[model samples]
Target: MKLYPIEAGNFKLDGGAMFGVVPKSIWNRTNPADANNMIDLTARCLLIENGDRLILIDTGMGTKQSEKFFSYYYQWGDHSLDRSLKKYGFHRDDITDVFMTHLHFDHCGGSVQWNKDRTGYEPAFKNAIFWTNEAHWEWATKPNEREKASFLTENLLPMKESGQLRFITRNENNFIEKSELDFGILFVDGHTDKQMLPHITYQNKTLVFVADLLPTAGHIPLPYVMGYDTRPLLTLSEKAQFLETAVKNDYYLFMEHDAHNQICTLQTTEKGVRLKEIHTFDHLFD
Candidate 1:
């Protein structure tokens, strides 16, 4: 199996929102903010080429949204999903499966796009089966008031309407040994309901796609959970358990939102689990 780090795009978000309750004086040391207080972030999706299947983890924010809507996020960068795919000598049509961690706009927005005529929306990857868990599918479709803004109909519905949407069978435990995508999944709920974190074993190493559970390297300090999380208290407990397991197994964390740091590993410290090392995808995988 071969894995590629796909740079979908980059954007800025409020540092305060990214690190909830954690003072800027602290988080700023790792994720420094701009004059406007927005910190750099990227939609670092993952692509796995396993035998006949070409699976993409997340789609990132697409370009279908209006300028006004995008202005809020302050997107900046030339990197795009199509361009990134072409970099690997592939295209969207080649993707057989699209495994979405969650249905947040920034994570799965690129799954659908405006048709050529601009008359209606359609699945971005026409030949791919868009994957999301049943619980998360329901949660995102009928979102609560707090998360409603993040779950846009334009980013969803089209996948279902196109008849390419499917759900992964989730197990009762926190981790699934093997999923239909042929990889392990760590089901976490602290960030969102039933967020599926892919645990891929490649090149004799376990690399986990650390989605929102740990957005940036700065968030490794336990208390620096995102304010966007619905259940902050639950996040604390979940993170503690996951961090402990990550340290024990010496797993490599593939960060999805961090713009600067691509991969990281944790080490047990007096303060708890802390950043052990940072690596580029090429340095470790290539």
Candidate 2:
């Protein structure tokens, strides 16, 4: 089995929102904010190649939103989903499974795109099965008022409409009942309801796709949870348990939203579990 890091694109979000109630004085040190108080973020996806299956975990927010809609997020960067796929001698059609960690726009927007006529939406990966859990599918489709803005209909629905959507009826631990995908899934609810963090065993190491649960290295601390989460207090407890497990199991965290660092390791520190080292995807196995 082999893994590749796919660069989707970069965007910015209010540092305050990203850091939640954490003081700017603290988080700004690791994730420095710009003059506008916006912090850099990336929609970094993972491509897994195990035998005949080429599974993609999370497609970054696609380029379908209007300029006005994008202006709010401060979209910036030259990286794109299609170009990134080409970098690895792959194409969207090569993807047999598109595993979504969650249905947030930044994470799954690339699942659909405009048809040739631009009359309606279509599945971005024409031949791939879009994978998401039943609980999250319902949560995103009938989004609550707080998360409605992030759950756009265009980013969803089309995959289901295209008859390519498949639901993973997971256990309480979020493991796919009959998962064919070659990875262990750790179900987390701190960031969102039933966010499946893929635990890929590669080269004698477990590389976990740390989705919004730990957006960046700066979020290693237990208190540095995102305000976008519906249950902040629950996030604290979940993070603590996850971090402990990560440290105990010697897992390599594949950060999905960290712009500068692609992967990180945690070390037990006096304060708490802190970042031990940072590595690029190429250097992870080396």
Candidate 3:
């Protein structure tokens, strides 16, 4: 199996929001904030080429939002979903599965795109089966007040409308067999309901996609949970357990939001599991 780090571009969010109760003095050291206190974060997606299946995890914040909407997040950088795919000698049509960790806009927005003629929205990946959990699907569809803004209809609806939406919950093992991208699914609810993290074993390394549970290398310390998480305390417990497991297994965490650091290894220290080293995806294959 081959793994590709797909860059869907970069955007900025309030640093405080990204790092829950953590003080600016702490996170600012890692991802230095701009004048407005917004920190640049990469919407780094992952692509897995296993046998006949090509799976993409998380689509990044799509480009279909209104100008006013984009004015808020400020999506910048030359990297994009299309360009990154082409960089790997592939295109949208080449994708067979889109495994969404969750339906949050930044994570899954790129799944659908607006038509060129502006008639309506369409699936960005034409031939791909969009994978998400049934419970999260229901929650996103009927979102609560706090999350309603993040779960936009334009970012969703079309997948199901296109008859390509499939729930990942039908499997007893919590994975699809034919989706030979064999990986253990680590589900965490503190950030969002049933958010799945792919614990992937590839090329002699055990890698875990550290979704919002661990957004950046700065989030290594257990208390660095994000304010956006629905339940902050639950996140604390999840992080403690996951960090322990990651260190115990000597796993390489594939960070999604961190712009500079792509992968990191956990180490056991007197304080407990802490950030051991930061490296890029290419460094791993090399």
Best by lDDT: 1
Residue-wise lDDT of candidate 3 within 109-129, one digit each (tens)? 999998889899999999999
Q: lDDT tens digits, residues 134-221, model 2?
A: 8899999999899999899999899989999998767655454236576778778877788888888889998999899999999999
Off by over 4 Å in 3: 170-181
Off by over 4 Å in 1: none
lDDT of 1: 0.95
Q: State the RMSD for candidate 1.
A: 0.6
Q: Estimate each model's TM-score.
A: 0.99, 0.97, 0.95
TM-score of 2: 0.97
| lDDT of residue 110 for candidate 1 | 93
The stretch of ten residues in a row with the least summed lDDT in candidate 1 is 168-177
Query: How far is 230's C-alpha from truth in model 2 (Å)?
Result: 0.6
**Which pairs of residues collide in candidate 1?**
none
